[model samples]
Target: MKLLMVGAGLSGAVIARRLAEAGHRATVIDARPHIAGNCHTERDPETGVLVHVYGPHIFHTDDAEVWDYVTRFETFRPYKNRVKTTARGEVFSLPINLHTINQFYRKTLRPDEARAFIAAQADTSITDPQSFEEQALRFVGPDLYEAFFKGYTEKQWGCHPSALPASILKRLPVRFNYDDNYFFHRFQGMPETGYTAMVARILDHPNIDVHLDTPYAPGMADRYGHVFWSGPLDGYFGYDLGRLGYRTLDFERFTETGDWQGCAVMNYGDPEVPYTRITEHKHFAPWEDHAGTVCYREFSRACGPDDIPYYPIRLVEEKALLSDYAARAAGEEGVTFVGRLGTYRYLDMDVTIREALDTARAFLSGGVERGVAGVPG
Candidate 1:
């Protein structure tokens, strides 16, 4: 069978590789010049620092199979995401851990004491929270919420926390202990060389043909037995039912000699600050040493027609439009929606790869017919 994989990112690459290995010829096409999509990484010519072209992506997951699969292509170095934040004119550890709690309140409270204190601070009056603001207030109280999350959330989503759903804040943890690791995943690391190199290896199968800078066109799927689209779900339908809302990022890149920031990610929790976070590229790969450093000051905004969509803003209005597109996608023949954009959800790197593997397995096993790989829930 001849298969077509659209948008040669992690989803397309992983699925294409699996199908190719199963004695099926796969052709992968990417609109971007590079294959890794948002995960693309390249070394800066002048600074010699490996820059994460689309932002910092730390591969952290509890899935052992996904970890083993990625390790086959590239060596992964030991990496833990210890995120820091600047709030109220002071630097603090993220995730609202014990250290952060004590430092912010200027008290040397133990784990139990801190937990009790935070519990007392929480608004027990609000039994069930609906919005992000209510969720934070009910859990961490106003002080921590305002100092850390309020400003950052507003800047990232371009809306008041009250307008957003509580599910957003539910993902973030408020640890009582001193563990400052951003993610609680068992396995956490980064590709030794870069994500692009790792993806290149994944696409290096004999039965797979990769074409870059090729955009998907109407009737392109006519020649192939099946099509796996990882591009925007609305884009596949020419956004006929109106475009789904998304939040895009604008990166302000700068180069400096010597170490600029000691940490890999430094988020600004002050709403007054224009940018949300600053990432030091060299710190992402601690194994490699470079005298010069490269950094990106990231700012998030509403995605326009011409902009590269990052986060899907699934508000009530967007959800209605998404439903229409999803229904249209379900009826489409010989096509399966895959990955974040296709499913219209925010997906981590590990989840994306895992879903891609499962999609390929289902197709190979003859379990999936058409438009059933990754449909929006």
Candidate 2:
């Protein structure tokens, strides 16, 4: 079978690789010139530092299969993400660890004492929290919530926490101990040669052809035996119902001597500050050394028509719109929508790859139509 894979990101690349390995021909297309999509990394022309072209993406996953799969293409160096935040004229560790709790409150409470103390501070009245604000207040209480999450969440989403879902705030781990590893994933590391090279390897198979700067639309489906679309779900349907919500990022890049922030990611968690975080690219690849450092002050805003959507804002209305799109997708034959944009959900790189692989395996097994049991409307 001849397949057309759209977006050429982790999902598309992995799907193409899987299909090609199964003795099927697959052609991959990406609107961007790059292959890795948001996770694209390249060398800075001026400073000679490795720069994450879009933003910092730490490859972290608990699945051994995913870890083994990614490492096959490119060697991964051990990298544990330890994030920092600047708030109230002070620097603190992220994920609300014991150190963060003690420093913010000016107390040296142990794990047990801190847990009890925080439980006391929480608003127990709101048992079933609906919004991000209420969830934070209920989980970590008012002081920590305001200090760590309130400003950052507002800036990142471009809205009040009250308007956002509780699921967003609860995504991060709340640890009583001092363990500051950003992700709890069993496998956490960055590719030694960066994400672009890793994805390039996945698309290097002879049965797979890659077309850069190409957007695969619905009309292109006629030319292929099947279509695997990783583009926006709303875009496939021409926004007939309504446009879904997304938060895109604007990166302010600058060159600096020596180190910047002494870490890879630093959050500006105060309302006074505009950008949500600053990322030092070189720190992501600690195995490589450079006298100069490249950094990006990441600003988040509402995603426009031409903007690259980074995070999906799956509010109640968008969920309704997504349901409509999913229903439509279920009725459309010979077209399979995968990945974050296609599914209309935020996804890590591993989950995207895993799902793409699963989609391809299902397709090769020949049990379903267009890799789905049914077609979309």
Candidate 3:
């Protein structure tokens, strides 16, 4: 079978490789001039430091298979993501651990006392919270929510905390212990050779051909035995049901001597600051030492047609619009929508690869169809 894969990112590369290994001819195409999608990374010409083109993507997952799968392409250096935040002219560790609780309240409370103190701060009045604001208040109280989440959440989603869903904040954990590890995943690390190199390895199979600077044309659907689309779900249907919402990013790169923020990522929780976080690229790959550092102050805004869409704003209105696109996509004769953009949902690299592997398996077993709509699972 000859397969056409649109978008040579993690999802497209993974599925293409899997199909090739299954003795199928797979050709991958990406609109961008490179692979790895948003996770694209390259060595800085000035400093020789690896830079994450879109944003910092620390590969962290609990799935052993995903971990091993990535390690196959590139060597990973041991790294743990420790984030910091600035609020009211003071700095604190992220994930709201014991250190943060003690410093914020100016109390020397132990583990048990800290837990009880946070519990006391929680608003018991709202038993069943609905919005992001209500959920944060009920869980961590007004002061913590105001300092840490309220402004940041508002800036990120471009809506009041009350308008956003509660599930967004629920994923973050608050602990009485001093564990400031950003992710709770069992396996966490950065690719030693950079993400682009890893993705290049994924597309290195003899049966796979990658076309950069190429956009998928609707006419190409007639040229392939099967089509796997990883572009925007709405774009595939020509956005007939109204444009889906997404929050894109603008990166302001700056050069610095020595360490910039002394951390990998620094969150500006204050509403006064427009950008969300600043990532120091060198800190991401700690094994290699570089004298000067490069950093990107990331600004989040409403995604326009020209900007690269980072996060999908799957609000109620967007969901309804996506449903219309999904219905139309179901009628596409030989296209399978895979990955983040294709499904119109935010997905990490591991989940994208896993889904691609599953999609390949389904195709081989004759269980997968072209023009399937929505998420696979």
Candidate 4:
């Protein structure tokens, strides 16, 4: 069977590799000149530091299968995402850990003491937290919420925390102990050569063909046995219902000798700060040393039609549009949706690969045109 894999990111690469290995031909196409989608990374020519081109992507997941799959393509260096934030001209550890709590209150509190203190500060009035503001007040209280979450959330999503859903704050890590690691995943690492090289390795099979700078047309689906689209869901349908809302980022680049911030990621918690975060590219690759450093000040805003969409907003309005698109997709033949953009959800790299692997397995195992929507079971 001949398959058409759209996007050429982790999803398309993984699926195409699996199907090609199973004695089928796969053609991978990406509208961009390169692969890896938002997770794209490359080395800085001047500083020799491995730069995350799109943004900082720290590979962290509990799924051992996904970790093993990626390691096969590229060697990974041990990396932990320890984020810092700046608020009121003061620097603090992120995720609101015990250290942050103690520092904010200017008190040396143990884990138990810190837990009880936060509980006392929490708003008992908000028994059932409905929005991001309510959830923050219910748990962390107003001081921490104001210092850590409120301004950042406003800048990130371009809306007040009260308007956002509670689930948005639910995913945020708040540790009782001093552990400041941003993510709680067992497996965390950065690809040695970069993400693009890893995806290139995945699509290097003999039976796979790659076409960069190629746009996907609905009519192209007729040329292949099946089309696995990892592109934007609304984009595949030409946004007839409406353009699904998305948050895109603007990066301001600067170079400095030695280290810029002496940290990989530094969040600007103050709404007064125009940018959300600044990432030093060299810090992401600690194993490599350089005389100069490269950094990007990231600013998030509403995605315009011409901008590169980073994450789907999935607000109430967008969800309705997604449902409409999904209904239309289900009725279509010889086409399947996969990955974050295709599914219109915020998916990590591990989940993306796992679903791609599962999708490829189902298709190769005589499940032709069945269960190929790429939603993990």
List model 3 lDDT by residue over 247-302, tens digit each: 98888999888888898999999999998889999999888899889999988889
Model 2, TM vs. native: 0.97
Candidate 4 lDDT (Cα, whole model)?
0.89
Q: What TM-score does structure 3 among the candidates reach?
A: 0.97
lDDT preference between candidates 2 and 4, better one? 4
TM-score of each: 0.98, 0.97, 0.97, 0.97
Ranking, TM-score, top scorer first: 1, 3, 4, 2
Give the range where candidate 3 is weakest over 10 consecutive residues by summed lDDT.
368-377
- lDDT of every predicted structure (CA atoms): 0.93, 0.88, 0.89, 0.89
Candidate 2 per-residue lDDT over residues 1-377, each given as its tens digit: 88998888899999899889989999899998889888998999887777889898899998889898999999999999999999999999988899998998999999999999999999999999999999999998999999989999999998899999998877888889999999998898988988999999999999999999887655788889988888888888888898899999998888899996899999999999989999998899888889888899999999999999999998878877777878878888888888888887788888888887788888888854442222233
Clashes of 4: 0
Q: Which ten residues in a row have the lowest lDDT in candidate 1?
A: 368-377
- Pairs of residues at least 3 apart in sequence or in different chains that clash in candidate 1: none
What is candidate 2's CA lDDT for residue 317? Answer: 85
After the best TM-score superposition of candidate 2, give how far the Cα of residue 38 lies from its true spot, in angstroms: 1.0
Best of the candidates, lDDT: 1
| Candidate achieving higher lDDT, 1 or 4 | 1
